[model samples]
Target: MMVWTNILVPVLGTASDAQPLSVAKALAAPFDATISVVFASPSASGLFNWAYEGGFGVTDVAVAAIQEETERGRARCGELLTALDYPKTSFETVTADDWLGLRSATRLADVVVWERSAAGGHGFFASAFQQILLDERRPAFIADRPPDVGGTIAVAWDGGREASRALRRSVPLLKKADRVVLLTVPHAMARPCDGARAVLYLDDQGVRASTDVVHTHGDASPAILDAVRKMDANILVAGAFGHPRLQRFIFGGTTQYLLESLVRPALFLSH
Candidate 1:
C-alpha cells in the first residue's frame, strides 16, 4: 500500500479553512502523517484587478489598503493555527508569489486537502485547488464535512489511466476502510474493463473490494452519487478529469458534475 507521510492544507485566511484543517488532522492520524498548513495570500495582480473592477482605480491608497487586508489575513491564519494546537503540524506563510509558492509546496506533499467551498468558483483558492490536481498531478481530498475515514469508501472506476491512478493513490485510505466498493458504469466509461480486474487488483493490495455496476443512459455523476448515497459511503475516490489550457483548466463533464453536486461524501481525487 502507498504510504502518505505529508499532507498539505493551503488556507486562504478564512473561517472555511478550519474545516479542511480538521479533516486533514483526521486523515493524517491513520498514517502518522505530518500536516503542513500554509497561508496563501491572493496575488497582487488579482487584487489589483478586483480593485479596478470595483471602480477603485489602481492608486497608491488602494494598493496600501489591499496590502493591509493581506496582513490581516495572515494574522487570522496565525490565530487559527494557534487554536488548532496540532503537534505534528507546521505553519508557513506564502506571500509575494501565489501560484509558484503553492506549486512548490504541492510538489512536496503526498496529498493536498481543502474544504468543498475552496474547490468551487474561479477565485484564487479554487484555481489553486485545480492546479494542485491537474498541474501538479497530486492527489487531493475535497471535504464537504469531516470524513469518516474508517467507514465505507466508494471508488469510481472506468478503466482509464486517470481512474487507475486515482485507485492506486487511494490504496492507503482503502486499506483502513471498513468496506470498499468499486462502482463502474459501462456505458459511460472511456476505456471499459472487467470489474473483476479491479476487484483482483484491490485484493492483491490486501484491500478486499466488491464491484457494483450501474446502468446509466446519460450523465454518470447522478448514478454514481446515487450508489454512493445508497451505500452510505463517507468518501468517494475518483479520477479528476481536467486539462490545463491557455492558463485555465477545463473540467470534464462527470468531474464538473460531481464537484457541483457533492453534498454528503467527500471526494478523494487525483488527475
Candidate 2:
C-alpha cells in the first residue's frame, strides 16, 4: 500500500489551476497531505521561439519583455495560492528550466495533479503531463473537475504491470472511497483472473471492492466510460500505457482515448 505524504500541483498561472488545486485539497483531506504548488514558467528560449513565430525578432527588448511576463506569471501563481489558503501547502516558483524543475519536484511527491485540459495540445503543460507519466513513471491525477474523493472509485484492471502499479499506488485513495469497483474487459486481459485478484488485493488493503467485467467489441474506451457513468464513479484509476519510439513517447490507443475524452471521470493514472 502507498501512502501519499506530499502532493504536487503544478500551475501555469491560469484559472484552470483551481480545479486541480481543489482536487489536491480533497485528496489530501483523508491523509493530511501537504500540497506543493509550483509555478512552472516557460523557458526563455521557448518564449522567444513563440515570439519569433509571432513576427517578433529576438532582441534585447523582446527578451526583457519575456522576463517581465515570466515574473508576472509567477506573481499571479503566488496570488492564486494565497487565495486558496490551504493550510498544509507550500508555494515555489520554477523558472529557467520548467521541465527540470518539475521533474525534481515530482520526484519528491507521491502523486502529481494537473488540470485535465492540460493533458492535450502541444503546450508546456501537455509535455509535462506526458513526461511525468512516461519518463518519470509517477502517478498523476488529472482532474476534469473538483473530484469527490470519498465517492465511488473505479479501477481499470487488465493484470498488466502498469495496471498493478496503478492499483498499488492508488491504494490510499481507494481505502478512502465510499465504494470501489474493479472493471475488467476479459478479451483484453492476458490473464482473466486478474480482476478477482485485484479484488482480493484491495480487500487486503482494507478497501472493499466489487468486480464488474465489461464486454466490448471494438475500442474499450466507450465501454469503460459507459460503465463508469452508469456506476456514477467520481474517479477512474488506470495505468497509462505507452512506449518510447525514436526518443518520443507515444501513448497506447486506450490511454490516448481516455486522455482525449472530453466528458469522463477524473483519471488517476500511473505508468
Candidate 3:
C-alpha cells in the first residue's frame, strides 16, 4: 500500500483558509499520518531593506507582522483541529525561512494539500503547486473546501507513465474507497491493459475497482467530469501532464480543464 507518513500543508499566514487543513486532516485520518504544517511566510530581509532612511525600517515592521502572523497561524491550527474533532490527528509546525525553504518543505512531503484558484500566477502557493508537479513529481491534493473521506474515487487512466504514477500514488486512498472507478476514454481493447493493471494492483490491496471506458468525441475532460458526477465520486485522482519544454500548465488539456473547472470535492493530482 502507498504510505503517506507525512502529509504537508504549507500555509501563507494566519489569513490562510482552513479548507486545506481540513482536507489534509481528512486525508490523513485513515492512515493516522502526521499533518506537517509549514508556514511559508515571506522573509522580511529578502523583501525589505533593513537599512532605510527612516528610523523605523520596513524590515522591522515586516518582521513584527510575520511573527504575529505565525503566532496566529499556530493558534488557528489548534482551533481547526478542535473544530474538525480529529483528536487522533498528530501534527507539527515548521517555519520556512524563504521561498526556497518553502519549496524544500514541499518537496519532502508525501502529498501536499493546496487551494485551487482561478487567479493563476507564480505566487507562493502557485509556485509550490507547479514545482510539486513539474519539479518534484509529487501528488498535490487540491480542494476548495473540506474533502469527504471514504467515498468513491475516480482515476483518469491513459496508459501513460504519468497516469500510472498517479494510480500508484493514490493506492492508499483507493484502499479506503468504497468504490474505485477507472474512468477512461474508448480504447481499442475491451478493457485497456493499463486500467486492468491498476485494477489488479488494487485487487491485491482489497480495493475492487471497475473500469469504465466512455465514448467522447471531443475533449476528454468534460466527459471525465460527467463521469465524476455520475459516479458520485468524492475525489478524482489524475496525472498532471504538461508540455515537455514549457514551464507552464497545458493550455488545452485535461489537467488545465480540471484545474480551472473542478470546484466541489477534491482533486488528487500527481505528475
Residues 1-271, candidate 1: write the lDDT tens digits.
Answer: 4788898999878887788888888888888899999888766677787778999768777778878888888888888878777778877778635477888887988889976665664455777776678888889898766678899999988776677888999999999999999988877765646678888998999999999987788767788889999999999998776344322211124555667884458889888
Off by over 4 Å in 2: 45-57, 96-98, 242-253
Q: How close is candidate 1 to the true structure, as a TM-score?
A: 0.86
Best by lDDT: 1
Model 2 agreement with the true structure over 1-271: per-residue lDDT tens digits: 4678999998888776777888888878678899999888766788787778999778888788878887888788877778777789988877536487888778888899977666653455887887777788889887766788899999888777777899999999898899999888776555646477888888889999998888876667678888989999999998775434212111123555676776578889888
Clashing pairs in 2: none
Model 3 vs. true fold: TM:
0.81
Weakest 10 consecutive residues of candidate 3 by summed lDDT: 245-254
Backbone clash pairs in model 3 (N, Cα, C under 3 Å; residues 3+ apart or in different chains), count: 0
Q: Say which prediction, candidate 1 or candidate 2, comes out ahead on TM-score.
A: 2
The 10 consecutive residues of candidate 1 with the worst lDDT sum are 243-252
* Structural similarity to truth (TM-score) of each candidate: 0.86, 0.88, 0.81
What order do candidates take by TM-score, descending? 2, 1, 3
Per-candidate alpha-carbon RMSD to the true structure: 3.5, 3.3, 4.1
Candidate 3, residue 106: how far the Cα is off, in Å: 3.3
Q: What's the lDDT for residue 127 in model 1? A: 73
Best by TM-score: 2
